[model samples]
Each structure stands twice: as structure tokens, then as C-alpha cells.
Target: MLTSIWQAVRRAVRPFAAAVVTALLGVVLLSGWLDAVDWPASGGWVRAHLPALAFFAVAFAFAVQGIGRVVRADRPARSRPVGLSWWVVVLAAAIVVVAVTGATEWLLAEADHATDRGAARVDAIKTGLGVGAGTAGIFALLLAVRRQIHQEHTAADTVLDATEKRVTELYTKAADQLGSGNAAVRLAGLYALARLADNHADQAETVLNVICAYLRMPHGRLSPEVSDRHESELQEAQVRLTAQRILGDRLQRFSQNPTWGGQVDLTGAHVAGIDLDFAGLSYARLDGATLIRASLQYADLSSASLVEADLSHAKLTRADLEDADLTDANLAHADLQGADLTDAKLTRADFTGARLPDGMEFRNGLVVRT
Candidate 1:
């Protein structure tokens, strides 16, 4: 009957809870199941001697553990216990068990075995041996639990290392694809890297840097001599728009959750018809870049460069352009109300149909009329 129950308990207690589960199962199974066996005398004696039964349960558990140690001699080493040696903890536990057991026996008149001289000495010796075996079993069980936990942690670390390696390989492959001269291949690479970044957020900044570099590359009509004369340029334009859309999507998400927080450098690169509304572009370099009809409402462009750039009909309402350069730039019909132009260079810059802020005038790009 106990065998069947022990097997059930062993199957039930898995994955974790080794020490506690074993101790509990041992106590319940070996206590002889109070319901199955009959107690001597009336129920009063058994009721009064409840603590004695508990001690017997605990001692039986330890004795079973001792047998297990003998059977498994090649068990793994134990980890160090926190702030206490294993033996020290075992000794303290043994002392407490012995005291509780002795008290229970004495209180329940079961100390009659120690009333005679010869039997008393034998009982003392037996008690001592039981405590010793229980302590040793407890020490072994603690060590076994620690070893199991350590093995699990090591296995988890191995799996994580393998996963990281695979991710790195995928990232390298996608980067190679992006560098291909074929426009279709480059577009595929962009989507692949974007997917990678989405799955692995830690790579978002690195992936973003690559996309930014591609946009920063000189590949516009201004450089038609080295530009691709084939249909690839038109396809590349679509690819650039896709890249801009991806980047702008991430940047505009700063209000809800900021994932990408890196500086963008599009100096001397054409960025027309891109939707960058509410994007975080502080300290960016857009000098000489054509931003015709670009939506930059409430965008952060503080300390940016726009020298000799064209911003005709661009949306700049409430945009942060503080300390930025606008020399020889065209801002014809661009909205600038609530825009910060403090310490910005506006020499030879056009602002026709653009709303100027208070204490500012567009003539000669001066804040005050001279």
C-alpha cells in the first residue's frame, strides 16, 4: 500500500520542490496511515500523543533518506548554502528534532522505556543514532537539490548562447544582402533587417544606423554623372521612401514608447515628400538637403544644419529649429508660427507666405528691422 502511494507522490513531485516534497512524502507514507491501523487503548491516548506521532513521522522520513544516500553514492556535489554550512544547518535541525521527539515521548508517558537502567541506556543510544542518521540524510538531500538547480541553470545558459549565435549569423546575412548592387536585393535586405530588428529589439539601433547610412549616400539628380542611369534609380527612390517610412515610424513612436533614440545624419542628401511629422530629429545634419513639401510639424530639428537647402512649402509649425542654420535656404510658403528660430542663421533665406514669430522680421534675416 505504501509502495503504491510513494510511487504516486514521486510522479507528482517533479520539475522542482525536491527537498520539501521528498520530506513531505516520506512523512505521510511512512507514518503507517493512521486511518488504516488501529491504536492501542482509547482515542484519548492517541489524541494526547499527537506530537509523538509527528516525531515518529519525521524520524522515519530521515531514515528512508539515509537508505537513499547508501544506494546513490555517486551523487553530484552540493552547492554552498547561503550564510551557513550544510553540516551546521543539518546539526541544528537534528538537535531540534531530538528535542521535539524527546518532549513528545516524555509528555505522553512513553518515557516509561527510559524508566529502567539498562533499557534507558539503550534507548538513549538509539535516539542518538536516529538523530545522526536524520542529520546526514538532510545534508545529502540539500546538496542534491542545489546540484539539480545548478545543472538547470547551466543548460539554460547553453541554450541562450546558441540562440545569440544564430541571431548574429542572420544579421550578417541580411547586411550582405543590403550591400548588393541590385536594387531588388537591397529592398529585400531592408525588409529582412527590419523584421530582424522587430523580433530582436536590441538590434534596432544598429539596423537603424545602416538604413540611415544608405539614405545619406549621395544618390540624387544633383549627382546624375555617377547616378544609376537605368531604371534602378527610380526603384531606389521607392526603396529610400520605404526606409524613410520605417525610420519615421519608429521616431514618431517616442511619445508612446521610445525604441530608437539615435541621431540621424542626412547631410547634403535629398529628402523630398517624406512624412517626418512629430519625428525626433534633434541635432540632425540636413545642410543643403532639399526638403520640398516635407511634413515636419512639431518635429525636433534643434541645432540642425539647413545651409543652402530648399524647404519650399514645407510644414514647420511649432517645429524646434533653435540654433539651426538656414543660410541661403528657401522657405517660401512654409509655416513657422511657434517655431523656435532663436540663434538660427537666416541670411539670404526666403520666408514668403511664412508666418514669422513675435520680435522677428524676415528682411535681411534679422529679428528686428534695422
Candidate 2:
């Protein structure tokens, strides 16, 4: 708003400036022409009337300003109002006006022999006070607009901070629910975290890591304290399945939306009969884990750790296993057609009934059958 005002002021002052320059040039030429007939009388009369000329010039400028304000009032306001401090423009205009008034008074007083110098001083003082008042009004207007802008910023920041704090509290509560002994509570916690990850994309990777850590907890038959009986084992299995489903859904390779691509750490975790077909698990950690009959067809396992893990009857057709570790792992009857096993470890790994691609064998690590 202030910027627009300065622009308007500039437009108004331009015509006044042109008028002053033209008038000064005309007077100088008129004086030279009048010198041939009578330089003293005619030229002196015009020069003595400078006070009236200055008054008319100032009146013309004010009339132009009034016309501009009326036109602006009829126009609609802009959506985003650009503003700046335009007090400098106002001060410059006030200085020009005061200088013209003082110059006119000085010239007229010098021309008249009986002109009261005391009254001229009083009029000059009055003009200065009026200019100062106008300048102050312009400064106050700009200051008010600047204050409104600062208040809006403060309010927006306050709301954003409050929302962030609320989200953090909800995440903490859901994470605590995962540790409950009740299976329903654990299931609720899994769904809660899943919803959180879906709604708040910034926290998706952290939520995924938490779910992976929970699945990696000791859930083997040897740890009777963790999975004592059939009921406890069934509940844990359901929770684990839910966690795995959440992970699998976000690993789609052809999805258009932004998906999670962080490292999965199910290292030495028991995840038998888990279906992860076509899931992206590149560079993942599953060393010494149990994955008997797991569906991993066409999954990306490049540079992944699966050492000593059981993968009997698992599907691996067209899977990429470049530089993966499978030392002492079981792979009896697993499909390996079109799968890349280049630079993989297979020391003491079983592949009794596994289907290997043409010209590839799994005798003592992968090698050309010829």
C-alpha cells in the first residue's frame, strides 16, 4: 500500500515539475524580449508577481492529487498489497513546496520597499509547521501497515508450533501402546503407527524402523518366555503379519506416489511363511533369519544379508541378488530362473532341488555349470 502511494505521489509531482521548468524558461525568454521596449517597468511587474505564480502552481498540484484519489477510490483493491516506507517521498515533496513558498516570499519582499519582514517570517514559520504535520501523517500510515504484517506472521508461527507439539504427543502414545501384553492393544498400535505414517509423510521412515525393530524381537520357540504357548504364539504371529503387511504395501516399485526406500533391518529375525513377493528389499539385513517357503518372487535383494537363513521352497524367479550373502543358507527347491546371483556367497548352502538359470550352478558358490 505504501509503495502504491509513493508511485501515485511520483506521478502527481511529475506534472508539477514540468510546469515549473516551462514557466521558468518562458519567463527568461519574455524578459529578454521585453528588454527592447521597456526592461524596467514590464519585466519588473512580472517578477514582482512571483508570489501569485507560486500560489497557482501549488494549487494545481493539489488539484491533480485530488483527482487521483477520486480515481483510486473507484478502483478495486488488489489481493496482495505490496507496501514500503514512502515517508521519504512525502518529505521530499514537503521540502519542494516549502522551498517554493520561501523563495516567492523572499523575492516579493525584496521588491517592495515597505514590505513587513516580521510578517514574512511568521508566514514562513506557519508553512514549515504545516509541512511537518503532513510528513508525520504519512509516516504514521506506513508504520501501521508494517505492524499488521508483523502480527500476521507471529500468529501463523504460533499455530504451526502448536500443531507440531500435538503430533509428537500422539506418536509417543501409540508407540507405548505397542508394549502392552494384550494382543488387541498391539494390533491397535500397529494400525495407529500405520495411520500416522500415512498421514505424516515426514515420519514414515522412523515409523517403519520402529515396526521393523518390534518384528526383530526374540520370538523363537527356544525363547519360551517370549512365545510360551500356542495362544501367545498365535497373537505374536498376527501382530508380526500386520507389521509385515504394512511394510510390503509401501514397497511397490511402480507406484506414482512418493514411497519409502529406507533400509529394512530384520536381522536374525524369525519371519517364516511371510509373503513379500515383488517387494523392494535391496541392501536389507536378514542374516541368520528363518524364511521357509517365503514368497520373494522378483524382489530386489541386491547386496542384502541373508547368511545362514532358511529359504527352502521360497520363490526367487527374476530376483536380483547381486553381491548378496547366502553362506550356509538353505535353498532346497527355490526357483532361480533369470535371477542374478553374481558375486553371492553360497558356502555350505543347500540347493538340492533349486532351479538355476542356464549355464549357472550352485555347487560351491554360484559358477558356470560348464
- Every candidate's lDDT: 0.74, 0.75
Models 1 onward score TM values of 0.63, 0.62
lDDT by residue for model 1 (5-86), tens: 9878865654235456447645754674533433224346778999999999999999989997885676675543344444
At residue 1, give the lDDT of candidate 1. Answer: 100
Candidate 1: 10-residue stretch with minimal lDDT: 34-43
lDDT of 1 at 347: 80
Estimate candidate 1's alpha-carbon lDDT, on a 0 to 1 scale.
0.74
TM-score of candidate 1 versus the correct structure, residues matched by position = 0.63
What lDDT does candidate 2 reach at residue 245?
83
